[model samples]
Target: MGSFYVTTPIYYVNAEPHLGHAYTTIVGDALTRWHRLLGDDVTYLTGTDEHGLKIRQAADAAGTTPQEFCDRIAPAFQRAWERLDIANDDFIRTTEPRHHAAVRELLQRCYDAGDIELDTYSGKYCVACEEYYTDDELLDDGLCPIHKRPVDHFEEENYFFRLSRFQDRLLDWYAAHPGAIVPEFRANEALGLIRGGLRDFSVSRTSLDWGIPLPWDSDHVAYVWFDALTNYLSAVGFGDPAQDHTQRWPVDYHLIGKDIIRHHCVYWPAMLMSAGVELPKGWAVGGWLLVDGEKMAKSTGNVVNPLDLVDTVGVDGFRYYVLADTTYGSDGDFSYDGLVARYNADLANNLGNLMARVATVVAKKCDGVGPAPRADSPLADAAAAAVAGATTGWDAVSPSRALEATWGLIRATNAHLEANEPWKADPGAEVDAVMGDALEALRIIAVLTHPAVPGTAAQIWERLGMTGALDDQRIPDAVSWGGYPGGTDIVKGDPLFPRIAS
Candidate 1:
């Protein structure tokens, strides 16, 4: 089997998990699930960035040590992912000994390569961002562009990475690897940062005690960004001599939010180049899930706890809405009304409606045993079209378009049932043909939509009395028309997604 490795940015452990975090993780999980469907050997990694100044401060305020604080808060993310049904292969923390070794080895490589040097620097720094910003980069109010808060001035003696030297190299790398960053515009944005100017960034901090210490300099700790970014390498056994890291080195995709574009796109590649490590194959940058036209944050008091909505809309309903409503690369405005509308229209009305109608009709007309579909079924062309569009969309990381294509088949099947009025027929061949086509359509849908809504898709599969685990179903062959060999007992159980009252 071919190999596919993907990672979600290890989340900062300063806050509890929220919808913004959920959005990115769910997208990664969906993409990995799609890879599994294609019969690829897939590895999905996600975890917490547990060591940083923010963590120390947050821990101090909570009357705990940094490690204790991380231990307490990191599980919140694990639990949240579990509740949302995320199937990540490993969750690496920056504070782990494995991560520490990886960070040190990377630092030593760059240091020995003459890329890291001691330097004295003074700059305006945003503690919230944990990075320095130039005067021109700041907002009109002399505040951070991201946090909209005043930055503190810091001058210190530290070690810096020769990022300035990699401008030409990074440009050449991007030129060689076209479409390394998704949403072509974001790739251009990275190119702009490199073309505009390159500055050597500080890699070690003298004042931060809550981070991985530099191996060369016992007086300093590795920058949080550097420490956090290496989780990708460490989880794959980058620094462990016992493990063969090359099996999954050079991740297929480093899924991240657009806010950290500079770090992942610019700083990350430069560090890898300096350490003589292979650059990531690709980066999928996603826009923020905004609330009332602003980024969701604890400071804004607009953070939507994903668990709070789980009770209202079932997990699959929530998952379907996020993947179907947002275009994946664009900023999505999250509103209660929008959420309810998407859940109602897509889940409650479209997919759930299709499954219920097919099973009910088969039970009433075909004596509860699904009839075999025709090789020349009317939905054959529609199913083929859907599989084509969905394959393209998922390949391009466009979940909304992929799901839209899948839903098109649902809409078409519903129309086919309506046009034929299979229920009105007297259990005849005509009714059998139409109902059989609908059943076949549903089976194809279960495979197509499994990545986005696995739980709901499995339920549909079980209700159809298909033998074996739904997860065992592979793509292409499984999705082809006429795979649903009918004659299985069809269970018209409870509504898959009951409509939520507006």
Candidate 2:
């Protein structure tokens, strides 16, 4: 098996976790899970960005130290991921000593290469975004475009990365790797930024006291961009020789929102080049989850608490809707009515109904013992087609498409059952063949859809009386037709997904 590493941009601790945060994290979790099913060793890393100007200010507002403030808020993200069944391999915090070491190493390497030099700057900065904005990039009122607030003027002596020198190198790298960024449009955007101009960005801030100190210069601390982005490396032992860094050095996918394209696609790679580090293999940039035609933000007063929706539909239902409703690279409008409608339509009426009908028919027609499926079962071709389509969709990082392909098999099997009328047939070879084929189809569906809905898939596996942990089942081999040997007792338990009231 090959190694696969994926990451979600670490969430800032300045605010509590919201639906926007949950969507990115869930997508990472699902992507890593898919890799695991393919028999690959996967590392899914996500955590909190605990050090920034915003964090220092937030601590003062809370009447506590920055560390205490982070300690209180960081666990909220961990708990939210747990509630959503996010199976991340590592949860990193910027405050961790390991992360500090990695940032220092990267900084020293860039400094040694003459890519970092002392500089002074004065500009309008957004406390919310912890970024500087040019006059042309700001609103007509000279406010931060992202937060729509007055920008604070800051002048400081800091160390800057010589990003200007890497312009040609960055362009050449992108030209060599055509698909380095998913959704080809984003790759073009990164190329455009390089083509426009590259400026030396500050790597260390003299004003921030709550950050990792530079290795060569103790008076300055690593800036937010440098410190926050190093978590991807620190979690994988970038500076620690005791761990095998080469195994997963270059991440397979760096999943991020469209808003941070410049930082990830542009700044990150240039930083890596200066440090003599390998660049990430691919970047999957997703658009914002908008609410009422506006991005969800505290300033906008439209942030969605994912937990509240979880309380409505169960965890799996919530996970399925978000993945199925949003095409990964495009904006998705979030609405409560839309969520309930998707749950009732796809889960309760379609998949859930199919499960109940099959188990009940097996109990009555085949004496509750699932029979072995026919090698040439009517559903075999459909199952093979579904597998191909699902694999293609997942490979392209399109969860909506992958799930649509999976449900194709589910829908097809339901139609097959309806046409045959297995329930009406007497308990004979005819009924056995139909029921057995349905069970086989269910087995394949369980394996294929396990990544998106792990708990629910496990439940389906259990009710099928399948032996062994579902997670241990590998793709291709496990999903091949006729893998379900059947002859085990079937349980027609409660509905897997009960209908949600309109």
User: Which pairs of residues clash in candidate 2, taking residues 3 or more apart in a chain or in different chains?
Assistant: none
Candidate no. 2 TM-score? 0.99
Kindly list the per-residue Cα lDDT of model 1 for residues 1-502, writing each as its tens digit: 5899999999999999999999999999999998999999999999999987899999999999999999999999999999999999999988899999999999999999999999999999999999999999999999999999999999999899989999999999999999989989889988999999999898888988998889978899998888989899999999999998889988999999999888999999999998889999999999999999999998889999999988899888788878887888899999889999989988888899989989888989999999888999989999999999999998888888889999989999989988988878899888889988998999999999899999999999999888888889999899999988889999999999999998
Candidate lDDT scores, in order, read: 0.92, 0.92
lDDT of 2 by residue, 244-326 (tens): 67788799999999999989998999999999999999999898889898999988899999999999999999999899999
TM-score of each: 0.99, 0.99
RMSD of each: 0.7, 1.0
Could you tell me the lDDT of residue 253 within candidate 2? 93
The runs of at least 3 residues in candidate 2 whose Cα sits more than 4 Å from the true structure, single-residue gaps closed, are none
The true-structure Cα RMSD of candidate 2 reads 1.0
